[model samples]
Each structure stands twice: as C-alpha cells, then as structure tokens.
Target: MKRQIITFATLIAVVMGVGFSGCTKLTDFEDTNVNPYASTIPVTQNLLTGALRWLPATVNSDVGAIYAQHIGEVQYTDASRFLGINFAYDDFYRGPLLNLQKIIDFNSNPETAPTVVGGGSNANQLAVARILKAYFFFHITNRWGDVPYSEALQQSDNLTPKFDRQQDIYTDLFKELKEAVDQFDSGAPVEGDIFLNGNPDRWKKFANSLRLIMALRLSKADPATGKVEFMDAKSDGVIMTDAESFRYQHLAETANQNAWYARYLTRFDFAISEPFLDYLKSVNDPRIPALADKPTDGNANYVGMKFGLANTTGIGNNSISYIGSGLREQDSPELIISAAHVLFTLAEGEARGWNAAGTPDQVAAAQYYVEGIRESMKQFGTYDATSFAAYIAQPEVAYTPADAIRKISYQRWIALYLNGYEAWMEWRRTGFPILDPGPSPLSIDGEIPRRQAYTTLERDLNLGNYNAVLQSQGPDEVNTRIWIDKP
Candidate 1:
C-alpha cells in the first residue's frame, strides 16, 4: 500500500509539473536547482580587471583632453569652448567604485575571507583595493571638489550622503595611501593584479608617488602641509624611472584596445590643437611626428585645427593632423603617471625649497628637470642623444633661476601630453605655458573653466545634497574655484 501511494504521488507530481508549467512560477522550482557556478557574491580576483581597465579610459578621454588642449573636436565643440559641463558622477559611483568596494568587502569579511584570498593574503588584497579606492576617489574629488566622499557607495542605506570638503577628502586619501602601503604583505603576494603584477614593492612605490602628487596639489593652498607630505613620500621612495612608471599595457584586441585609438582613429573626429602644434613647432620639438600625423591633404607635416571652433568650417576633413600612430594605435599604452611626472614634481619641490633632493638651487632643479625631459623622450621612443643634446641647449629649453618654474612647468606639460587630466590640474595650479583657448560662442567670461559643474543627474536625483554643496561650495558654475585653487 505504501509503494502504491508513493507511485500515485509521483505520477501526480509529473502531471502537475507539465500541466501547471505556464501558470506556476519557474523561480519556485529554480530555488532548489541553483547553478553551482553562479553565486550572489562575486569572486574578489575577478573584480579588479574591470576597474583597472576603466581607470585609464576615464582619465585619458574627452573633457580633460579638451581642457588641456591635447585634442580639438572636429564636430560639435561645445566642450572645448569652456561652456558649462554636466559631468555625471553617478556613472563613477555605479561603475569602477562599486567594483573596488566589492574587493574590499570580500577580503575583509571573515566568512568570505578564505575564498577571496585564494592565492593572496587577506591583508594584501585589502591593501590593493584600498590603494585603488584612494586613487579613484582622488580623481573624483579632484574633478569636483567637496564631493560625497565619506558616505558614498552606501547604496540604498544612504542615498543622500553629505558632501565632504575637499580638504578633508585629501586628508583621508593621504591616510589611505599610508595605511595601504604599510599593510602590504610580501609573504602573501597579491594575485589577479593587472597593474603591478602582485609586486608589493612596486605597489609601495606607487602609493608614495600618489602621495607626492596630492602633496604638490596643495602647494598653493597650504605650502607647509604640502612640503611635509612631499618630503615624507619622497623619503619613503617614489617612482624613479620609466620602468617603474604606472602604465596600462593595452592589447591589440578590440576589447583591450587603447581608448583614444578606439575613439578617434576610425572616426577622425579629433585633431591636434593649434596651441600644442605651434608650441612643438616653435621648439623644433622632435616628438611632433610621434605626437601627431601629417595632414592627409599632403601637407607632409602637422597642422593643428583651431581649438573650440564652431565647426570644422574653412577646413577640409584631410587638412588637420590626427593623433600620431604611436599613441593612437590599438596597442598603445595608457600612462597613468610617468617617471617624468615624479621627477618633475621633485624638481619643482627642489626649486621651491620643499623636501626634495639636492640644494634649493637652480642647478638642483635643472638636474631633475632635464632628466624628466630625457625620460619623457625615451618613454615616447623618440630619444636620440644627439638631438636631445641640441634640444636642451636651446636658451628657451635650458634652465635658469629666473625661468626655473616656467621651464619645469612647461616641460612637465609637454611630458604630460595626452595625459590630459594631470596637464589640466597642473595648469590650474602653476599657470605656466599660458594657454589661449580664444573666444568661443559658448564661453563664460571668455575664460577657460576652473572646474567642471556638477551633473544634472545629481541635481535631479540627489537634489537636497546637491543644492547644499552648490550653496556651500559656490554657484553651479565652472568659473568658481575649488579649495585647492583658492588662497
């Protein structure tokens, strides 16, 4: 009787399974048949690659380049015109930042700790995540001062986080970098790292180098504090050569191609700017051919388009020079920070009597400054000893105490070509090689933007906090200076 009853129930279950397939919820059955490969939580190692890939794409593109005058828009030139910008901070919060936060969460959780640290130490993985978090936050905060820092990424719990002052944010970033470096465990190497290849020493150098960058940014606002941070980071050992520079080695595949090549090459929507081209041409800069291509109109040399022009009017498609193959090729590397940048930073510190190498003299500044230029040249694969010798001997390029700052700033500018955000930041700080974007129909006060305006999305979605930040920081305008830019 029991066997017969079990057979009858089995038959009923089979009949119901077929008969109620359309009406019953599939997920009810799926609850008991979950895929083993699928999990609610992500594997920590898998989260890092996406963040690293996206960082360069964000850093090396669009508004920053336009502001720095590395590339001019061939079509609509509103962005290059110093018009009001609506930078969507929402994308950042939802994207790379989320991924980085995941890595931190997975490694820090005791329940998921072993799985997350499968090939690495819990401390090392967490440290790497923290360092990257500091980096992304640094970029975000630098772009828009007094952003939602402390309480951001809270998701549903804290949708309305208060904007943290840029000063406080900087302080926190310094702390993160210091702590992350200190926490690196050589015994348990980091795995699945695309940036430093799990090398703790390099990561340590990177942390110190980033601190140097932050320190120099405070030069105008707080010289005393800036000097202290600069000296401390340099003493801890910052990036010293091209071999140690932070860069992304892009692959030739469609998915892993360089961002610029993907954006500009096939479309031909961007061209070298007149200011940049003229500057290089004026100096007989050897890097010109490496930086830009000859015009397709048979000019046999580079010719720049006027930046922020209304349209590509009075110019044929073939007249303007495209970004050169070396930089705009599929496999071109995206440089995050170069040895040149560090050397130049140190050179600037030395010139200003901050905690940098050598005496606070012109000779000391010149030494680092010249090496920065050399390293930059080598970085571009354009270094010829004979040419470099003649190039530096020029009175304009040669260093003198009266022109020390200008030379350093200008060379730093040159080395930072295509690395637009850094160039724009330096321009904001030092105001050297004074750029002229000229008049534009869309410009406010006929001046280049001091800062990007908060996005419309922020105003719409997080209006209360957005309004608070606007009221406290300044008007929602690009002309307003951030804390770092102010006295």
Candidate 2:
C-alpha cells in the first residue's frame, strides 16, 4: 500500500510535471515497473553533459569581457560600449536563464533523464542529477538574488508558484545537497554518470567541496548555519588534494568541446585585457606567455586588444588602437572547483576566525595554495600546461597568512583567468587584488555591475513569480544584494 501510495504521488507529479510531457509514466521510457533498465540512465546523463557546455558558452568572451572589465563602473550601456551581448541584459533572458530553465525542468522531473547508455531506473544516476540540480540552482540564486523556487519548474501547473526569497532558497539548497550527498555511496555503476565517470567517491568529493563553498558563501548572512554545513562537509571527503577534484574539460569540436576553443578558435574575437595583463606583469607571472599575447605596443610583451572593437571603425575609441596579442590557440577547460580553490576557501575561513574542516586554516591553506598553483599549472598541462609558480617565488611571492587571505584570493583570481566568469565571482566573494578603475560607457553603477538585472522575458513567462521576486528584491536593479552581500 505504501509503495502504491508513492507511485500514486509520482503520477500526480508527472501529470502536472510542467514541461515534462515525456515523463508522465516511468514505463514510458523504461520498464522500471518490473525489471529496471540500466541503459536508460543516460537520459539524465545527457542533461549533465549538456550543462557542461554552459560554463564556456556564456562566460566573458572578448566582446563580453570588455563589459565584464567595467561591470564595476555604472554608466554601462549596450549602444555605447559594444557590450549588448553580454551586458545589455538579453543574454540571460535568451541564454543561461532559458537553457537553465530547461535543465531544471528536466532534472526536477523524470521525463528528462540523460540519454546515457544505461537505463533510467538507476538510483545512482538520480543522485547525480539531484546534486547537479542543487549546483545549478545555487548558480541561479547567486546571480539573480531571489527567484521562483517551490513552484519553479512546474510549468503550466506551477504558473503561480510563489517566488522564494533568496534566503529561503539558500536554506533549501544546502539541505538538498546534504540529502543528496547522503544518498550517494560506492554504489553499482549508475547510467550516464560521466562527470566522475560513475565514480561515487569522486562525486562525494564534489559534494563536500561544494558544501564548503556554500558554507563560506553564507558565513555572513547566517554564520551559525554556515558553520554547521562547513563541519559536515569537512567530515565528508572534501577535495583536500589532487586525488578528488572536478573540472569542466573542453574540446575543439562544436558538439562537446571546451568553451575556450570556441572563443579562441571559432570566433577569433577576443584579446587579453590591459587590467588582466597589468596584473600579471606586476607579478611577472610565468603563465602569461602561455595564456596571452606578446607585443612591444602592449602592456607586456603580450597584450591583446579589446574584442568586438575594430581599429578601422574610424572612431577615436575604436579598438583598432592595437592592444597587442590575444589569449592563445585556445583557452583551457573550465574548472568547476579545484583542490587549490578549496584550500584557499579554507584559508579565508580561518583568516576570518571560522572553523576549518580539519587542518589549521593557515597551515592547510598555505600548503594548498602553493600546491594549488602547481596543480593549476598541471590543469593546463604542457601545451595544456597552466599555473606558473617559478615567478611566485620572487619578492612579492611566498606570501603567508600575515599577508592574509587576499593573497589566496589574488591567486584564485589569477587561476581563473580566461575563465573570467568565475574570476569575477571570486573577486566578489573575497574582494581582493582590486581592479583598477577603467572607463566603460556601459557600466550601470558608477562602477561595474554587482549583479545582473532580472530579464524582461521573466516578466512574461513567469510574471507572477517574477513580480514576487522583484517585490522582495526591488526593481530587479543590478545593485540589489542577494543573501551574501554583507557589505
């Protein structure tokens, strides 16, 4: 009877499963009713695979990077700055916001399992999807502030789902991640588990590291809550070393390649920024040559011009001013999270006098950051090589906790180069290696934008919920503080 009840509930969920017409019955895709199918699991796996495409897809390209460079400035505009694609506010409405909506609608229901080789009845695959779901939602809240939650992926059935406040969403995200982590173990091969290649232990590491990030993010908004999550993750297998890690690898192909390949190979659109170049020049970072351009006319032997701007525009401000060289043959894979980043996170936690997972804040972080620099270099690999530390030993190198968490953050920022979306995020999280003031007509704040404005499409697609979010957030302006903007 209990099992029947559960099945009934699932059916109700399916019947009103928003956009999931394909998931109305488990048997619709697989014969989970009797003998479960292992091959069906990839349906959900496909979702995870597709999601990998996004990090490279939406991040700051040469054109987008220009706006990102000045997101700190206020006058930001699409017409004047040539930043309409990344900054004019349509990208979210059309790209991430919409695609992510599709991802969630699928993960939230059974219809959209990855089209992996295995069957869909595998509990392991579901576990992975749930965790990814949590990560996806976390990204959304981080960027958009409060958003539609409880009723969020319900489609027509949930058209009026009330928007959950950012705080509440954070509350649920940690809980779900915790529950999802608990559900995982060294289980049998689940279908389509490509991120870890079906390795439960690796997935555990991802969960723990992410939990640490979530804890750190909320330390200010809710310190006690943050510590609890922190304690639990440390006890779990957080990526303390290279053994357990996660990175989004890219390819040269359009189907499933690294984003950098697209930005550097396909578009030929971007160049290294002066600010980014100047920062590296100060440290004489060894990775610069591998990562950027070399020209006597540039900030360093290598400097690229701002993308999307043509020097031939005959406009005084035309980018044709010749900034120098650009990134490289292509960029590297997008790092989702790394041991080095985890170490720096701990360092910052300790500097702030918070409890670290197991090791002393300073000791663990120092060792981690040093090793992280090395690993980062490894992440890039020979041509694939990245992270240059030979230069870190210079006078400005070898920083200890005395120099503070800023050192760790600055390193993280450097590690995140080319991967500017994350670089920008880390800057906001730690506020280090302050970017020098630059000029951009597109800035919305006297400085660059602190957050993206709520897109106009939401006003139509999810108006009631969108309005609820706006009511709490106020006008959907770029400067509204989500949960963590303590300052």
Best by lDDT: 1
CA lDDT for candidate 1: 0.81
User: In candidate 1, which residue pairs clash?
Assistant: none
Cα lDDT of model 2 by residue, 68-114, tens digit:
34111112224224333223333322333343444445545655543
**Cα lDDT tens digits for candidate 1, 310-420:** 666778879889888789789888888799999999889888888544347667678988899999988888899999999999988988877888989988888988888
**lDDT for model 2:** 0.56
For every candidate, C-alpha RMSD to the true structure in Å? 8.3, 8.1
Best by TM-score: 1
lDDT, residue 178, candidate 2:
78
Lowest summed-lDDT stretch of 10 residues in model 1? 1-10
lDDT of each: 0.81, 0.56
| Candidate 2 Cα errors over 4 Å, as ranges | 1-121, 185-187, 242-244, 265-267, 295-300, 304-332, 356-361, 382-390
